[model samples]
Target: MSPFRKVPAYCRQSRTPIPFRQKQNEGLEALNTPLGAPRPGATRRKPAERAVARTIESDDADSLRAGRRRLGVVLKPAAQARSRNKLERLLEVGLEMMNEIGFDRMRVVDIAERAGCSTGAFYQRFADKEALLEALAQRFAEKAWTLLDTMLIPERFEGQPFAVVVRRMVVVMVRLASAHAVLLREVVRASLRDMRTWTYFSAMRDHMMARLFEVAGHYPEVTDKAAPGGPIELAVQIILSSLISRSLADQRIIAISDDDYAAELATLMIRYLVIDDAPWDAALSPTVD
Candidate 1:
């Protein structure tokens, strides 16, 4: 989590990670989304119709090479059509229920009912209700990593002012929290009892700091590779902490919308960096660049 003077470069592999599985997928028809649902194509076709049919037949092979679903946190791996469909339905229903009624009150039976399945079917997929949460957390981490890969590229902010960069970064994080509000809140709650939950999201935090430092441009370049950290790095820590605190706690303390929150955070960081008449302060105001 410590900030470095030089821009940090993570290998492409580090940014987007999926669960590891050793065994390859069997060419189960249900696995082809065979049970998931069919695409729209009912009528007879032209000369290439035969070719297309051959391609459809090859989907099982494709599944062997690619299309295999990444089964995260499920105790029983599903490859058959009936079982795969049930597994998919359970996860969909469980996520919806978790979103609707907090995870604490969501029941396996309730999710099964909504998915038009029985409790036995749900049990066939997950060991317990908590397994559903771990699945969601795993999916959230996948999405979060992809989001960070796309969102935190400093190159995207090139030619923009550092102030604008800060505001954009704040806006992105606020919107991310909004989109995954339920998962994030649960992670925050669970993190108190088990700090492991925090580890999943911490990389995003560290990535954001590095991105901000890169976008800060040459205005306040850090020379000390060694750190109690540079002023800008420390300032970013405060800004990021403030945003996280707002997301999980003290919601009643502020009444502003996400837009206003971003504005305030960006303003806070800029002002802190650009304090008046400070002999040692590295001002990041618009006047600097």
Candidate 2:
């Protein structure tokens, strides 16, 4: 009676359609089969392709190792630079404290404070005030050696004129003294009163003179045959004695200009050592009484 109606078929079927279910089973079997297993259209990897893949993987590992090594090298300098910066900061603070408060008045606390660090940091960098002073002295020694190398080294003066070499050397010495006047003055004062300080200064002096002797003696112009003992000792004694004498005498004088002092000392030196055209060997050899 309703507008929408259901229809029923009363026809009898001879057998249930088992073939339809079998076909569905076959389709599911196909679905469960491994892909690219001798299939009609699927592709499979060849032995050569597998070998290529292994080679690529090996190359990738090697490239990664090379990259890490290069990165390590690049990072190494950054670490060193940071360490150097910290050391420089410590040295700068220590030097500043010494200049402002005087070495005797400078304390580990003050230096560390100035450097924005703990006193422990100062200890890590320097054992004590004396150690810092020694470090400063070593720096000066290296610089002095560099200057000496320019003028006195055999290779540098191989074909140079003796007069030119001597003039340049005197200038270098004066410049070094001027630049290090404060440190030198402090050392000189301490050396006059303290045996330990004197020994330290004497050791440094001897070391420098030994090098000078070696270089000067090597020069063709000042060979051992021409100058005997080594010009190094003679030069050191003359320079040191003159410097000490002038410094003492200046203390007695009210005020003497640097020019006047230098001229006086130079004149005395030339009179004593440069008067005669002495053989290079005689000039360099050990000093006489």
Candidate 3:
């Protein structure tokens, strides 16, 4: 049986009234009456009433933005360029302030001041500092990926030894980490305390590992066990562990080049993945279907 029923015509008519003279008359009366207390010649809104009047008159984001813009308190770019320019400027200012004051100490007001706007303008663009930080993290990650993509050439791997492929991949990762040290440091810190950061890193790390396993699958000579316990696991552990260790060690040593770390890590990984003195076909037999 149907639980819902159509309303009877009379019930519908009673619930939803057809607007006529009653609403029209009320509207006309409102327009004719003075909003505040009427005076002899001029209707003078009281001081409190006047403030309320002004509040109601300009009670919107656009109005507040316009007011600030008119006072030269904010930058008012065209709508087409507004979002892009505002976000870029916020990230630039936020990062600088974060570096100087630390993330927790940096306030939205400080960011707004650096941005040459008010707190209202900053809030209009970002809900809070964390949201702004997330945007910066995402942008930095994208830039890092672009750097890695440019350095890693898959075609170079086709005829070369697996050792060469491993070298190039590790070198690229180290270089990328070097290029974005500030971003990486902040993201790592944020990832430790922030759930959103954890989710992003976890997904990105898993996806990259998944791709490595897929590529490893193409070369059956590489492994017998499933990743990340196979050849790919050794590579992943070497790359991540060495990168982290080198970053910490460099703070003490101050002369650790990414190339040196890459070369060393790459050699170790190659020693692990490559079979010594065994022919490729003999070393890894295709699993029988």
Candidate 4:
């Protein structure tokens, strides 16, 4: 015998009625509803809950963009005068805050407040604190490069004795280091935590090394030691490290005075690189008749 059960026609018709599907239609309608609108047959979310949802969505979007930015995204500079001023103000305030409380403790909200802007404005330019720091690091790198390029030109030291040139170079380096001492110290600390920071500083070091090599080429004694990764490179590294350490360290605790430290560093470079005469000195000296 076939075991088959037949539904009553009336019950079958009731099951397929339009009203029964209306609930399902309402659910679909709810899914299609735009944000900030109430769903059919559903209670509206509280204002706080709606706000939290918006915040989450906004943050998620910002985070995705920030992640992309962290991975070598290039942000465009502001072209409008007002935007440029705001950007500069934000950076200046951020630097001051970072110096005062250090990067780890610095807050974007505080930076915005100090700059007379909103946190939203800060995020518009810098995706996050790390991005802000990267900007500052780039700024410092550019300034340092400009200073080194101007000061280390071979022609500038053409007639000067080698020791005098070394002293002048050391003074320029010291001035640069001292001017950005706090920011650099923060950068050093950030480098310990962030690979981007480390990469930036490493690039700066490489650039300065290249410039030093160019300058060293003008002196035979230094040039003789200037083979790639040679003693001249080592000496340059030592001079850079010493200047950075002195700038970041507490002067009161250090045994040497600033002048003495600068002099010693200059002497160290002079002796290490054996820069005794300018490249033109031998030619420029009066020949015996």
Order of quality (TM-score): 4, 3, 1, 2
Worst 10 residues of 2 by lDDT: 67-76
Which pairs clash in the backbone of model 4?
A: none
Residues 149-255, candidate 2, lDDT per residue (tens digit)? 55566576566444434444454554456555556665566555655444545655665555556655655545552332444346546766766555444344626
Write model 3 residue lDDT over 1-289, tens digit each, in one string. 7697534332265675535556566558767877774533556668999898787876675564532321112234335566657657877898787767667788898789888778887776666776777766666655545544443444535665655556656666777666555555666677678767545455555656665555555555774633766666756776886665554444557566666766777777767765432122211211111
What lDDT tens digits, residue by residue, belong to model 4 across residues 1-289?
Answer: 6487433332355565345356567668888899887665678889999999998887765655532333122553454678778987988898888768888888888899999999988887888888888888887777767766776777877756666666766666666666677877877777778778657667877877787678778877667776678986787689888766875788676776444566777778777765573222222221211
Q: How displaced is residue 168 in candidate 1, in Å?
A: 0.6
- On a 0 to 100 scale, what is the lDDT of residue 127 in model 3? 68
After superposition, the stretches of candidate 2 with alpha carbons farther than 4 Å from their true spots are 1-79, 158-160, 189-204, 218-232, 244-267, 274-289
The better candidate by TM-score, 2 or 4, is 4
Q: What is the lDDT of residue 210 in candidate 1?
A: 66
lDDT measured at residue 193 in model 1 versus the true structure, 0 to 100: 81
Question: What digit string (tens of lDDT, one per residue) describes model 1 on residues 13-54?
Answer: 676433222112322433665554653354556769989988
* Poorest stretch of ten by lDDT in candidate 1: 280-289
lDDT, residue 138, model 3: 63
